[model samples]
Target: TDIPHFSTTDWTWAKGALQTVDRPYGPLLNLLHHGIGSTHVCHHINPRIPHYNAWYASALLKNNFPDLVRYDSTPIHKALWRIATRCTVVSQRGGIDGYFYQPKPSI
Candidate 1:
């Protein structure tokens, strides 16, 4: 429904990957890291030590969580991943519409 939100960390990671030269998923990685990495597009920064690392943690949670990971095979995940990574899953963005939208990152 929205442009898709992401944390600053997500934005940075995607940005870093995009900026890297000779990286396999250059275009797609950049898209995910910067394209959708936003407060509106992703979880808000943690009140304490809020930064890119926070979003990186978010990625880890989404990947390890069983229920969340299950969505990887679902159509929504399929479509989003395809669009973001261009069919290449070099990195993972965790959660769905509301999962980490207001993320309060753990220490």
Candidate 2:
């Protein structure tokens, strides 16, 4: 994996959380989803944090690590269309580390 090495354990944990989780929806839906869908970043970073406390943890992560915390605001419907139309989700990165949906080249 071409995963970049971190200089400190804190950064390693934060970056790892960012890469592993995604906040797919806004706060309103987050409550409906029990934060698992919206505050997923914090959950992965510290699974010990309860769902109710996760929202706060997620806010802290976003405020402290704005660059690292990425919340995809794309409408779910549109995102689905994009996935169905052209992009076959390419999850395997051949030893690379990071989360992204890449399109496979059309055959």
Please provide, for model 1 over 1-107, each residue's C-alpha lDDT reduced to its tens digit, 9 standing for 90 to 100: 21234445555544333221111223465456542332111233232424455446546645664232211222334445555654222223456321122223344
Tens digits of per-residue lDDT for model 2, 21-96: 4536666776677868777778888899999898788899889988766666665556567668866564545554
Candidate 2 global CA lDDT score? 0.65
Q: Using alpha carbons, what is the TM-score of model 1?
A: 0.22
Residue pairs with backbone overlap in model 1: 4-41, 5-40, 5-41, 5-42, 6-38, 6-41, 6-42, 9-52, 14-33
Candidate 1: misplaced stretches above 4 Å? 1-51, 69-107
TM agreement with the true structure for every prediction: 0.22, 0.59
Clashes in each model (backbone N, CA, C under 3 Å)?
9, 1
Please name the candidate that would achieve the greatest lDDT relative to the true structure.
Answer: 2
RMSD in Å for model 2: 6.2
lDDT of 2 at 58: 87
